[model samples]
Target: MRFTTRVLLLQLSTVVAVVLVSTAVFIVLAVEQLKQEAETSALSIARTVAAAPVVRSEVALETSRQINPSAGELATGPLQSYALDVTGRTNALFIVITDGEGIRMAHPDPGRLDRKVSTSFEEALRGEEVIAWERGTLGDSVRAKVPVFAPDSREPVGEVSVGFARAGVLDDLPGLLFGVGAAAALALLIGTGATLVLRHRWEELTLGIQPEELVTLVQNQAAVLDGVGDGVIALGTEGVIQVSNNAAEEMFGLQGLEGMSLQELGLPTDVIASLEAGEERDGIVVGDRVLYLDSRQVDRAGQRLGSVIVVRDRTDMMELSERLDSVRAMTSALRVQRHEFANRMHVAAGLVEAERGTEAAEFLRTMRDRGPVDYPLAGADLLTEPFLQSFLGAKSMEAAERGVQLQLRDESLVLGEVGGVEGTEDIATVLGNLVDNAVTAALAGPAPRLVEVTLLDDGPELVLVVADSGPGITPGTLGPMPAAGESGPDRIHGHGIGLALSRDLLRRRGGDLWVIDPGGGESGRGAVFGARLPGVMFPGDDLREDEE
Candidate 1:
């Protein structure tokens, strides 16, 4: 079963077991209560019938004669006085009397007057009070018997007994038991429903949040690593292959080596030894390319669990560095050639001076017409050349055509063309977009529109600013932009369509875009867009450092 299913079943089983145990306990207690009630009701009915006045009088007359020999005087008559007192009273259940011989003298059934007594009467004659059990042959009755006494004596001469049917008490048990069973079943159902609801809520809270979630989170992280041009591998607590990205697969040629140890995945000997020794290893090459590998043990809550190894492809960067070194050599040779050319011009000027004034004047005029405009940076390669100056000249011309001025502040040392490892084209794209937007916004205003562009190198930051004097951005577009709607890109739209793309590019290179001092500048109404690229330098080809 799936892990989630197993969890749910385990929880549900516990609920079922508890409900069953509770139901069993309830039934046991209920049955005991019912038995006690039945016994009490049967005893109460017996007591009521045995205490009737008619039954009491017969016992009294028998006791009187047995005590005082003259008690026969009262027994010999029609028992008139005794019958009168017995019949006048109210609240009697069943009244019955039996003579000394165990024959009935008075009963609710007239025909039963002369009937012989049952064994219960004989037990009463022996002075023992008796109660019959429920559901016997005598019509499910509870019979209570008491010996009668004469008026003056304690000796018993007659017996009085009363009985009530036991069906009423016994019949109630089924319905009562059925009601208890139904209630228990209902409780169980409600408890089950409650358990399901609680369990479902718990499941939602814990979904994608277990140790398994951590595992899956690492898997997603590996996928991101694979998405990039980098290799990543993770090891579990036992040094097993926990995760491997596609780049790692290709880098180590282990595409089908999942679940294998790092030592078995064609890793370099040093890397494998590092894994065996449980020590971090870095900067190891596995294939034909240079790799910047960083390995460290994964830890949480101060406890070491496993290891993670990140391998970045640095081959291209190393090649760029080598190329830059070669170009620097070429630039040195070009500088020598330029120095020789200057010497040759001076010698020619001296020769012209020695020959005549007219030739020297002509030579100087030609030189002046054909002289090189001093560029701040120069090299054969496009990246090593002074591209910044060219870029600024081009943008300035475009802005001038649109009746706008693109000004660059020369406060900080100018950063020459950077080309060693970073891609200048990407940086140009970022700068070009900002400059274009500034020019466009500036042109939207009246003539004499101006866009102030500033570049500075603050410590650890390269700040570029493009502020435009136009109808300032609408207040409606100052926050995060939503996705596109039916309106096309040409129409006025939300923020960040251009800004977000520019920001994303900068972000990938560890740079950022922001609105700097919106209303703090000389023109309080214009917008100042700033891009900050980190670790930029003036003399080196820093732009090339971000190529990868």
Candidate 2:
């Protein structure tokens, strides 16, 4: 059966059972009550007959005379007449008077007078009155038997018996049952209507889905969520996280994200704003991960079911894009170098053609002495590794495009190269962040904007410093770095998480970053940032040098 029908039927059955049981109980109690009332009335009438002065004196006279009257004489007697009168007036079934020996003095039938009474009369003869339901020649009745006393003696002369028939006692029972039945019917009607209404309400609330189907849906949802690689977050209309799978939690570097607001999870401001506006987005930076976000509202059965957001990791693509830009810069630098080499070769050719062989030899010697790759930065020759030299040479191109001069200080020296090092990524990340920030700050500052860089290798550690001629920042204005494993959006020190992420990377390796100069450093009136990264070079480079 359909769920609604089953529930409605069950409820109706419950109501019916209750009403039936209640009506039956009411009928039984009503019958008993009627019987008790009948008994009480019968007993009351019996007492009145026994207390009549005329009946009492006559019975006393009969007892003293010791005469047994014939049935015809007793039937015409005053006691018989009085019993018949009472029986005729009241609704009693019978009224009888008996002598001390259990002989009936008066009865409804004249022939039965002076005969032995049909029912037991021992209690009445013993001076006690009896009131109970008893069976006799007439029928079952709620009967009362009372003792009549002698006029002057303390003994009972005879007994007065009054009875109300069982039929008469329960005469009003059908009416009582009708009333109880009416009430029970009314209750049933109300119960059935309420049950139907409740069934309808259940359908509306569950959207016609049964309990078992809902369970299956939940199971399917669990399987789908657990099996996906991308992060999926289900949000309520109020933007609270209602469901988050393991991938979602892991991607955000968080736990217990259920019921939490994305705003509280440290997502980028643009990302959160876009989500609140119900817009799809890309290149959302969360922690160190660049993510692509796709969001859509979920609707079912004409009802709005909030929204879902799927996040795809895009950091690798962003890194590749950065590498392509670097390669482009190296190509441009190489093209310029090639042009300059050709110009020098033409000058040497001119010297040789003029027979100035000495100057041509000197020119060739000078060309040999110069480094193979001409880096744009001032101290590029200090970097022996090709990757480090090419990377900064690219950063110089980027700074030049932004109308900021990028250079390296002459004091910079590297005891070991960063190529194939244990923590090359960490070194690159920290150095790149500092230089990027410096270039941006210079671009936003006054004229003569310049960014100066310094790189040094100390044993197993690498140090980097970048200073920019820009509007300096107040030291205390930056938000404090969150504790390890903490996630939040307030970690943004500038336009992005430049300082925060840089410091996090340094601290991850037992290294740290600090403000060497808030502003007005040696090179320019700009802020200077410093970082120390442990284990960026080969650990045994210094030992190998010592042995040598």
Reference-based lDDT, each prediction = 0.56, 0.77
Looking at candidate 1, the ten consecutive residues that score lowest on lDDT are: 483-492
TM-scores, in order shown?
0.43, 0.82
Model 2, 155-189: lDDT tens digits are 89888999998888889988898899899989999
Every candidate's CA RMSD: 16.2, 4.5
lDDT of 1: 0.56
Candidate 1 lDDT over residue span 386-471, tens digit each: 44545554556556656677766544344444443354444465566677777777776556777776666554456678777766
What pairs collide in candidate 2? 266-489
